[model samples]
Target chain A: MTGDGAPRTLFGKVWDAHTVDTRDDGAALLYIDRHLVHEVTSPQAFEGLRQSGRRVRRPGLTTATMDHNVPTGDRSLPMADDTSAAQMRALERNCAEFGIELHGMGSASQGIVHVIGPELGLTLPGSTIVCGDSHTATHGAFGALAMGIGTSEVEHVLATQALWLERPEEMLVRMDGSLGSSRAITPKDAILSVIREIGPAGARGAAIEYAGSAISEMSMEGRMTVCNMSIEAGARAGMVAPDEKTFAHVRDRPRTPRNIDALVESWRETLFTDAGAERDREHAIDVSRIAPQVSWGTDPGMTCDITEAIPTPAEFSRGDESRRAAAERALEYIGLEAGTPMEDVRPDRVFVGSCTNARLGDLREAAAAVRGRRVADGVRAMVVPGSQEVKRLAEAEGLDRDFVGAGFEWRESGCSMCLGMNEDVLGPGERCASTSNRNFEGRQGARGRTHLMSPVMAAAAAIAGHLVDVRGWELAEAV
Target chain B: MRGVATKYERDNIDTDVIIPGTYLKVHDHAELARHAMEGIDPDFHSRMEGRSILVAGRNFGCGSSREHAPIALAGCGVRAVLAPSFARIFYRNCVDGAYLLPVEVGQEAYESISDGDELEVDMAARRVRNLTRGEEHEIAPVPEIISGIIEAGGLFRYRVPE
Candidate 1:
């Protein structure tokens, strides 16, 4: 489509390709390739249709799965929790009633809606995917313009098979240079460090496309980790241009075209920003200097490198009054003092699972951290794989043994700790170093305090009985 | 409806807290509303029966773009949510669902209104009247474009123009 005869960037091309109607209000109605639905948000939308006595506009375009409410342990039907059981049943009923295909509980393909979409070869490059889950951005790892929507919006999509969204201003986040040697740093660390530097509002109203040598070299799982948390940094969605890595990840999948070579050639054309193409903003991070990051507060923005001390409320107060209040509240809730070395901030729990960091690599890294060391006494630790396939592959390599042997609870796959949906919850006033996306108050459970971190760091905190630098564990050497 | 605002003096009150992630499975509005704010206060369902306007600090509904949040709140009979700011997704969800009205009143307005003040929200006038204090604070109104959607009961009804 371009002069160079290669796809510039999946986003660049897809943005142009899916233009159904651009409104004067700046929003465009873009055609969606796949609509992934889950139990948590689809019911009302279906009800809305039923009330109107209308059939699904396009049943073939949508797929349903049960993830948010299903417990991570025991794949048996009729969930142990009555409320969860009802919700799962409701999903089964809704899917069957609407004639929508569903990967119900215990299905081999069943997992987090976001994880299964890609693994099942449903998320194709250059396609527009919408799910009710925020981490739907995970599909962008394959060069799709994947974004999350609300129930009403989900209903709108179901009715029209399209979404009206204001075109996000473009931004390029280039992570150039070689990675740091601390071995504790990872793509998760890189993204967290970037969010810390840019602040939460930095990427507001932008569609951020990650680029540069570092991003290109990352595996598909690593890219998913980066894009999954884009919303945390206030981006509409984060995307990586599809490349060889993207093609390799989806090449043999069910939906990928059999003419792989030609498909790659066509997809390559969508792989980069046009020369001198206009962008609203551009920022670069020299990955070499970043260290493993940990959140010491209620918001993702309130984070610092592991080596740094907790920030005093007074420090933030001088800058922005709102930030100051947030810092003070974070201190009050987290029960931590400003200027306290983060290493000294011990956690009662360590959770290494979420759409953000629960991929195979994250498990491998966490397993490496806990391979030989036992979980410290008085610390509760868990390892929930992101997907069933990820769980299978981890067990195939005995990664599960390393985790279980270290005293961490190795549970079945789903969005277990990422959201406190099932029994996987933290008790009141309990402090946790979580690998999940959010650190909001009571996110893990009622009165449970969450501190977001990388999986390796979560493992380190579980072992050290505190939020310590994961590099101190010498995980790389263990491998 | 009259009651003192037992203000949740915090910012970024995410949906997970408003409706715990566990309650999301239940499709029954009545059932889901029963657990609304159970994560924050166990008696929230009982406390928020016919009266109460949640007064939050800033950016309420700040995580996980879940629509059940507003639905759960409305089902529990919450009249309005007054905060300094709201996350984009939650804001849009509330508007589209036409359940709870989100008013973006400045901090000064929040400071002036005492915790025990009985107030009435005049949606049409874009103002909050503190009946206890004999004072009224003019709040920025929802944009006409969005108000129309709410007036029609919800997005579904709004889409079918008269």
Candidate 2:
């Protein structure tokens, strides 16, 4: 690795490259290459800048969008909620007053801030990025050192284009194997399995570099899904060392650099970890045996394979009474009986959207899964594309029609139902099979139970009216 | 012992509960203060009246990167948040804003600290003594990097002279 203790991991290399000042104490002022902004988190940051009378240091490097509180139902009318409308209007004023570019409503670029940064090629390899949303780690899929920052940090980045950050230790998780040959498991399952293995707060104080054959073979969309959940495991960020697949995705994207200069390619090549590079911790998973996963509890760690049973508190506790006590509470909140087969877990709603699994590839897979089948009786299923562009592409390919034909509501793009911020929400105590990231209590609605699964599985859940193992369900009947 | 400790015995307290999405549009600190911890404990705002510190279980501020979460707590008179662990983004936000000190403690220390206990936090000594119990518990010492940020009253004020 760097001949001893020198920066060796890809994260270390990028951190070293972008460092603006080395403080006496171990922290550094990192020059943020990209800063993404949104309605939920930026208004206060803009206020901070105004209070200080500071001009935005680099408006060109920052991008803003309206995502969290925006409605995905109708674009023709104003937001029905006053708070939603106010936040959207405030973001507009902030962007205009600061001369920062904002892809607001009706703009093709308007989407979840995390999704647009990568799709538009704003997220790049070996550069640092930050958004005031935890899922900003999604951009790390492109091998960028991306992180979620707080509102004050958002203001800091806006005012100085830099964030004072403490260097985190590195962890490398390698999943090597071919899953497609036997069973199909998407990156969503891979990461959920990882979080399940290492508890919710397991990777605290670490930046993870996902390596090995499986990660390299994953499509850009899959990598994004995996990296998007890095924060769920409490990792500062997650990267997949920009490879050919990563380069291919960014190449020719509308917002990417005009040309892939040879010099740039060579530098990106250097971003890889040197052979024998020492990691703070290393983990490996035999991905071949991994099945489609689903979270049964509020947190991401409380997941199991679809074929498995809802974990009993006794199984999770071992000898620890406190652990068992917590699991019991979680089970109570989820309203699922222990030792029950996952297949029997009924879901009243099936939501397919969020920064997590709302991309075009995700929609295509979901559309494929329920081509000829109809959503089960009494089940409400909806598809909110990650971005407006994704909706456009899905509609262009008739994917929207397939979903709509199957009784899935094909709606506009926004972070809908992922959190109950928007009007889209579950009635209290209603259970849902969701493609969104977090299943926290009230995330969908107060007392609403959410099972986190991949898009295909969620679609299958809609048709089955329960959590079904998509692997054996003859996924996508004759598209 | 100096300030009173407001104990919250819960784990994985996400940002959503700290400051719900409903008030995310409210930029006023005082307004946020009245709503802080209202989601999880409707009476928490009133309970935190004189206490300037919060003691909690692991993984406090676990979801979303809402700076308002910490800002809300800060406005509610929380000068420091002592937890066994914290979500990375929330911890960084606390350091960046100098809003509240994120004190790391072991599970033992977290359990030992009780509500209304006068906590005399000695950062230099890495010790927190509870006047109520007349007991001392060692806390995890923060890296110099973080303490520097706390001392400078935030990164904005921590700038080197141009």
Which one wins on DockQ? 2
Against the reference, the lDDT scores of all candidates come to 0.79, 0.86
The TM-score obtained by model 1 is: 0.89
TM-score, one value per model = 0.89, 0.96
Query: In candidate 1 chain B, what residue range of length 10 has the lowest lDDT sum?
Result: B1-10
| Residue A436 miss distance in model 1 (angstroms) | 0.7
CAPRI accuracy category, model 1: acceptable
Per-model chain A TM: 0.95, 0.97
Local accuracy of candidate 1 as per-residue lDDT tens digits, A46-139: 8888887878788988999887867887666556788777777888998898889998877777778877888878888888999998778888
After TM-score superposition, what is the CA distance of residue A425 in candidate 1 from its true location, in Å? 0.8
lDDT of 2 by residue, A119-159 (tens): 89898888899998888889989889999888888898999
All-Cα superposition RMSD per candidate: 3.7, 2.1
Off by over 4 Å in 1: A1-12, A76-78, A281-283, A476-479, B1-9, B30-55, B76-84, B103-153, B160-162
Error of 2 at A46 (Å): 1.3
